[model samples]
Target: MNNQIKLSKEKREDMIALIKAYFLKERDEELGDLASGFFLDFITENLAADFYNQGVWDAYTYMNVKIEDLLEIQKY
Candidate 1:
């Protein structure tokens, strides 16, 4: 599996801003734009796949439950 994740310019900026805000609020430290960008890139490359898989699993579970509920209602 490819380890690289691509984000559009707007999305990249948004992520960087979020990272900066997180550090500022949670760590009480200022994170520079370049540092935040690097951090975002590193996380996306290393952990995005796992996050994506978890999201897919969550969606599948939700859909399965909804389908079961629909099926039960259909029997009424």
Candidate 2:
């Protein structure tokens, strides 16, 4: 499929909640975009991969193919 499929309401909400959790955990705040002093790029990428592997959503898998390249390309 090519982005034609739609996720159910619960699945969509779950995705949003996951992103919210990541943002909150990374920023130590509920709104700010700043991530913890740690290597957030790594953390976020890994989180996305984990989500993809869980068989719930594929939003993150778009990055799965070039993950290694992305990791090498990112500065932080």
Candidate 3:
């Protein structure tokens, strides 16, 4: 599977902004636009898949519980 994920220009900028905010808030470090852009690129390239998989797993677990609840209601 191709591991490349593409983001729209607006979304890219938003992610960079978020990264900058994170650095400033958590690390007390000011991250420039260029550095934040590079950090976003690195995260998207390296970690997006794992993040996506985790989201899918979470959704699956939630749905299973909901389905079980429905089934139990139907048994009454």
lDDT of each: 0.92, 0.54, 0.93
Q: How many backbone clashes does candidate 1 have?
A: 0
lDDT of 3 by residue, 1-24 (tens): 787999999999999999999999
Candidate 3 off by > 4 Å: none
lDDT digits (tens) for residues 1-76 of candidate 1? 5657789999999999999999999999999999999999889988999999899999999999999888886643
In model 2, what lDDT does residue 70 have? 75
lDDT winner, 1 or 3: 3
The TM-score leader among the candidates is: 1
Model 2 residue 24 lDDT score:
77
Q: Estimate each model's TM-score.
A: 0.75, 0.34, 0.74
What tens-digit string does per-residue lDDT give for candidate 2 at 1-76? 3423345767655555666687778866563223232334444455655755566446456667579677888776
Best by lDDT: 3
lDDT agreement of model 1 with the native: 0.92
Better of 2 and 3 by lDDT: 3
Stretch of 10 with least lDDT, candidate 1:
67-76
Ranking by TM-score: 1, 3, 2
